[model samples]
Target chain A: GAWLGTAAAPHERPGARRGAEMKKLYGTDAAKIQAMEAALQLSFDRNCDRKQPKYWPVIPLRL
Target chain B: TSISASSKPGADPASLQTEQRARSMMRERFLRCLISMANKKIQFHMYEKVKVDATFGASDIDVLNFQVSDLQTPIGVQTEALIRCQDVISYSFDM
Candidate 1:
């Protein structure tokens, strides 16, 4: 797998894989996001859709 | 009292025909592919590239296809999907 990542800014879409329990999944500050993304070196947003239908997340920064 | 674990059997011919029919049905769905090699070759030579991308929604995906770019062949003219979309999710391929 060359790349596997979620959309950036999980809170923006809110319809992420975590469901309404998004807060419980990522803490209030996004530590899980950092860890998963760091481990994979890929973007991780709670978001599902990627690119097209309007390219987004800009560059998907790690920070 | 236990049944034997090792069992060997042959496929029934009627079942085999059913499997063949299934394959035939799928092939028929893509009838164009059933045409002569020359025909496929024509399409193959005509299109330089083919792209596939998915568009997911709140609960499911809406896979889409559209030509992003092409110089030698007709683009955005052909598209297919295994599942129908319930919402709008468009995508395009670029040359």
Candidate 2:
């Protein structure tokens, strides 16, 4: 009954939440840090897409 | 995230700003180091005493995965592979 009564907030955006967190963590340099992260992420995504790299060892090495 | 612990509750704005700036500087330096590793041969030391070498390609924003080329594993050489950061204990590259 408690689960049915509570509605999930649909207005919250994950990207916006991460931006706010970055601002809180980096203060004035949040934009710069965000930019660098964005660029690195883009490259990683592009390389993975083009190369289709599979995970080595085929299993968790630590766990 | 470690720096957040240093900022005590009810701390002054100036001190909080200083802490945040320090975190930013450290993170920026780390990111720059990753960027410099691109196209360089990196030696990764993993758990279970597994050591491998690969040409660094790119790393995810979260630093959770590293995309590399020509990964030399115990079995054989992998043309391209994605290495989980969790598996890697430490990685080194020449300047």
Candidate 3:
């Protein structure tokens, strides 16, 4: 079977579940990511289609 | 504004003061909760059930807080943390 798009195995720290999710979020629109982080989204998993690993959002949060 | 108890002939000033304070705190906490929920919903889009449960703790700064677990009908979450409102939610009240 094709492992493409599938995240790492369950035992894997960043397994397929996470890998698949990250793929969508690796690179995305900045405005949306800033919005998500502003709302206390401390964690950004692979499924995050907005930003990168740093879910805290280094950028200043705009009100 | 003239409150019922205030106008009452035998209203206890002490108790009324306490009630007023409590009401004020409750209003603050409730508004904070609403904003938090709205921000969470807007941000994650998946956090439609985000909630904020507040309690009057020993200190004004540290209020008891809770949230419904993720995806729970009433906003539920599993965690015991003393969350401060300013710590989260970049809220802007236009109205």
Per-prediction TM-score, chain A only? Answer: 0.23, 0.71, 0.20
Docking class of 1: incorrect
Scanning candidate 3 chain A in windows of ten residues, the lowest lDDT window is A51-60
lDDT of 1 by residue, A11-63 (tens): 24323434333332233323443333233222111122252233221221122
Worst 10 residues of 1 chain B by lDDT: B61-70
TM-score leaderboard ranking: 2, 3, 1
Residue A33 error, candidate 3, Å: 32
For model 1 the TM-score comes to: 0.19
Q: What's each prediction's clash count?
A: 5, 0, 11
Off by over 4 Å in 3: A1-63, B1-10, B42-95
lDDT of each: 0.26, 0.83, 0.30
* Native contact fraction per model: 0.00, 0.89, 0.00
Q: Estimate the TM-score of every prediction.
A: 0.19, 0.85, 0.22
Q: Against the true structure, whose TM-score is highest?
A: 2
Best by DockQ: 2
Here, model 1's chain A TM-score works out at 0.23
